[model samples]
Target chain A: MNKTIFLLMIFLSISAFMLVGCEFGKYPLILDSSVTSGAIRVDLNLPLPVQVTQTTSVNISELRNVTGESVDSMKFYNLTLLIDNNTSPNDAGITGTISVNDNALVTLTNVNISEFQTERSIFDKDLAGKGFQYHAGGVLFLLNALKTQSPDILNVTVVAGTNASSLHFDLKVKLYGQIFANTN
Target chain B: MTRKRSILFTIMSVVCLLTVLTLQVRAQNPLEDAIKQLTSENAKGYLQPFVTAFGANMNSGLYHSADISQLGFTLRLDLIAMGTVIGDAEKKYKATNPYDGSEVETATIFGEQGAIVEPIPGVQYQFQNGQVKTSFIPFFLPQLTIGDVFGTQAIIRYVPIPEVNNVPKVTLFGIGARHCVSQYIPAVPVDLSASIFYQSLEVGNLFEAKTFSLGAQVSKSFAILTVYGGLQYESMSMDVNYTYTGNIPGITVPDANVSLNLDGKNQFRGTAGVDISLALLHIFADINIGSATVISGGVGFGF
Candidate 1:
């Protein structure tokens, strides 16, 4: 009788304890964050026949607002640039270098202002390292700056190739991406 | 047995059971990542399915049959396994992309990854993927039932686990009673009973849940085979506490402490099952239909 009781206790204990704190499923999640450089404008005055260029800077200080801490990784997905020509003519040639955190990322080679005069104006269909004229080193520098720096900024400089004419336009850049996180 | 010795035996058995059960370790951050990714407002829809499924499972398998003894005392122990099915409707939800002010159809915590949407052409944003991608949510527990003081049975289920690794401690406690109604009737072909149960579950300080149910059951026995069915009215509610690490626009708070009180969707359920008795061993299986469908089974040893 003693042996039978002891064996019964052992069986019952093992059966009950095995079900406690037993994890049933694996859950993996991917989060997302949206980023944008608000409306920025470049203005220049023309008093001589020589061309003029001006730089406009915008502060990107709220990246951490969306990409919370303890995230596994984040990557840029689709990026686009929009321009509104306020004072410059449609036929004018615009050239400028875009920089992030004081590092030169891309230099536009006489991009025509007419391409942005349509009802829907968006540049760079392939911004995820495809068909975009961005230096690899510069792109990496920008991503690193956004990830590490608290107060990062993007600088846009526009130069008008047409002489004897003033230049003025508003520039905006939007970034969208995925953030990988695990719920373990 | 003397009353004092019986009470001492019960306490020793419960203590031994709890000590052995705490040896298992579980790793699950149930609400930590939800707050980080979905924030306060959106976390509700993302986690609603889990609350409903858990509530349905807790309300199921309360009893395999309603045949309490009318005379001498009997004791039984059961290990119940229950699962709640996840329907297609619980997979998706509509949420606003706060950055661009666009409505996007996104996945819930039990769904597939959401589709990437472009609020404005050339600018796209994606939603969070599902945390659990399964068709059913399962739960298991051990239950004890003792009976026959004037045709009534008492039921208890308790499991308390300490914090292990980084995961929090978990505790579940339930108490219930069943009364046989057929004992007062004459020439009844089926055994009839009514029961009421209340259960509470806590996961550290992050989550707390409470459920209550009142049910009526009927069963017919043929030698070693018994068939049972029941109808229950139940309700469940949960309170969640977490730190909101993600910021929302026009919201001045940072790292805000968020608390949400949510109610489960399952209100009424119908259950049907069969139980087979073999001397000292009993095995049973059942299915419940409610706001969600749940399947339950158990193995028990009884006298």
Candidate 2:
């Protein structure tokens, strides 16, 4: 009987502690990203054949939480556009633009392999001297517009200026922002 | 055991059983809840408040009575649980698409929209946005006290690096002293004492907390049962710095760190409880009333 009472007392004591210190909350800095990729094809026989364009759209609806709300504002600290022209023997120059709900937000012009190599070398120098080719920029205004517009859609179009049969490229964007919801 | 002792034991046993059953029923996805709260933008302002509440709860129920026998020893363990009552905040935001210079109106706290990564040509990876939500957490500590020098008892509590699943390495240490005032008045029927304690907790590099408390307590012993009451003044401070890295559907979180400092001053508290001792085994439970309600209980060996 003494042993049983001791054990019971121990159990109750632990339970009492667990019951009272039961609530807490945390606020953490968050970083999120979005990526898209596609190919652009050009035909010399076609009118305005100097340029070939490919467009794709991203749905931001899923970004909404239980409150049916999306971010009110955001800033894009890093934007990268990479083009691969190795598929074709001829070199192709590429330019790209990002739009939210059909409204243009960011435009990258004269994005080519040589320029990418040059920028990479400037940012990072190594004994190999080999560098990556990609277009990079910071667009806070564009992200703010996305938040203000609350557009459920984001569209991206990549235009390639080349005589090559096809040009393939990739686009990656990183955004940072706080989320606000209306409880009232 | 006497009739009163048996009845009190039965009541405590029933309460413990009910509490255990409630815990089983209340158990939910704590990880999901934690993530939701962390991702919410409005939760930023409430971080310090949450820490303050946590500190207050930690300071409560440290001691049941000021009575400490000269040359006596005791060992005890305590557990504390707390929850936040603050509501979530709401705000407006402006979004603009730079491509077309168009604007949109959206309502939600700020957080990462996540990223899509494709390593293979046909395979795609996407992550979801970060969200913050409120949750319940518990703290546990063990303490020891020894008395007899200069009418005072020296107290110590420690948890040498414990290995618990999902919890970081935790190290807790505390030092305190309890002085018996009744020692000077041997004819008094009531036991009187004054005590002060300081405790510090280090959970890896993610969290650190310190609390200092001073109180006076008195209890009258009747056979194996003792009823006690006390007034306490407590101060607490804490710091939290944690970073999260993971992959979720539709969103990729590369770096997410939550950091904050919390401090509280001169919180006065009142407490009352019952202590039941059978031979060397002791059981005590108490409730503290202050800025928050803190209920605590413990089992110990006293001689």
Best by DockQ: 1
Off by over 4 Å in 2: A9-184, B1-44, B71-137, B162-166, B184-189, B243-259, B264-266
lDDT accuracy of residue B149 in candidate 2:
70
On the 0 to 100 scale, the lDDT of residue A162 in model 2 is 42
lDDT of 2 by residue, B219-265 (tens): 98788888998888888877755554321222223456755565753
> Would you list the clashing residue pairs of candidate 1?
none
TM-scores, all models, native as reference: 0.66, 0.51
Model 1 misplaced stretches (Cα beyond 4 Å) = A1-28, A31-72, A75-178, A182-184, B1-27, B99-102, B250-255
- lDDT score of model 1? 0.67
lDDT per residue as tens, model 1, A1-184: 4533543564465445434433332444554454656666666565653555556654544443554435555544444456675677555555556665566666565566555443221224323232235555556654554455434566655444443255677766555445555444
- Go through the candidates in order and give each one's C-alpha lDDT: 0.67, 0.49
